[model samples]
Target: MNEIAVGAHAPDFTLTTDSGDVLSLAACRGRKLVLYFYPKAGTSGCTVEAHDFNRLKADFDAAETRVVGISPDPDKALAKFRLKQGLTFDLAGDETHAMLEAYGVWGEKSMYGHKYMGVERTTVLIDRDGKIARIWPKVKVAGHADEVLAAAQAL
Candidate 1:
């Protein structure tokens, strides 16, 4: 079960990004952070979600917010996906799933009759103080960025 909740202090983590740079939860402090978790990158749904976030990046920036996408993909795969999609924001790799578990996005998932462990599609909106302001669980890709942008703008 996802333990993270609104009004709670978001779990801290350090991850490797597609650009071979390090990103830490602490680094996002003092800024509105939109931390999004996806099952995988380059897949249809994930790609759409990434593109949607990338598309609204300017708006997010205007709202003084930063977006970070995290998945269990390795750094090399994340690099390829980031390059392929022309994503400007940080795409982090969680190969160990430690950060994903700390954020409660990693768990067992079932698809069609088969069960497997994977990342759940979720988004946590963090306030400038690093507390969770909102959360979107089991996200629907279509128009998701608009919804997130509205919330971020409100914050």
Candidate 2:
């Protein structure tokens, strides 16, 4: 697992968004960015996380930050989730899991005695200078967006 540390320069990446566009670390330069990684799309937990981020859209915007979600799902699934949830931010599919691995969110996971590889529900806050400002590993969905917003605002 490629673990990233806060204060380290964020590894740059470009991912294809649900809208057929793209979200790149370089594009978000000079502004804060929140990149949340989830195991799957359209699941209950993932939906709640997306909604939390969506609900705080205005607050995030006011904080001069951009929020983007990353997952291993295909673009089709991501598009559906974004539309169904009416999410204002971008959702990018990392089917290749390259970016996910670079951020160290993809790793061994198990449920009901079955071990497999998947995303670890991580969120990374990248500051304007492209350094990692904060990282939430094994994130709990409740109040997560609010917490991230507060951090972004502080930056």
Candidate 3:
């Protein structure tokens, strides 16, 4: 996978949202974006991360930044997860892992001494011009939304 870097143009993608509607990165031009990738829909870490972003959705909006979460889960699972968690922001379904791989977040991972291919928890901050402003790879959930919000506000 090609690693993305700051100042590089972000890879554009179109994916299905939890709402069953299509969302494209190209549509976000002229607006900053917080594109976060998670491994699974209903897992604990993923849930906490999603909720943190949800809690800060208004702040992101105020900063003129749109926050979207993506995972390999299907639209049905994504929708159910959103409904269960009451998340108002977009949660995209990347069932093909195409977006994940494009962002270099899909690769080898290890848990309990076992290795497998999976999506890495990552957050990419795209500037209004669609260039990568910052990337949080292997993100930790605690206080993470605040950090991303700070970056977005700075942009």
Best by TM-score: 2
Tens digits of per-residue lDDT, candidate 2, 1-155, equal 99999999999999999999978999999999999999899899999999999999999999999999999999999999899889989999998889999999999999999999999999999999999999999999999989999999999
How well is each residue in 105-144 modelled by candidate 1, as lDDT tens digits?
8999999999999988999999999899999988989999
Cα error, residue 53 of model 2, in Å, equals: 0.6
Q: Whole-model Cα lDDT per candidate? A: 0.93, 0.94, 0.93
Residue 44 C-alpha lDDT in model 2 = 95
Cα error of candidate 1 at position 17, Å: 0.7
Comparison by TM-score, 2 against 3, better one: 2
Q: Residues 1-155, candidate 3: write the lDDT tens digits.
A: 66999999999899978887788878999999999999999999999999999999999999999999999999999999999999999999887888899999999999999999998899999999999999999999999999999999998
TM-score of 2: 0.98
List the candidates ranked by lDDT, beginning with the highest: 2, 3, 1
Off by over 4 Å in 2: none
| Candidate scoring better on lDDT of 1 and 2 | 2
TM-score of 1: 0.97
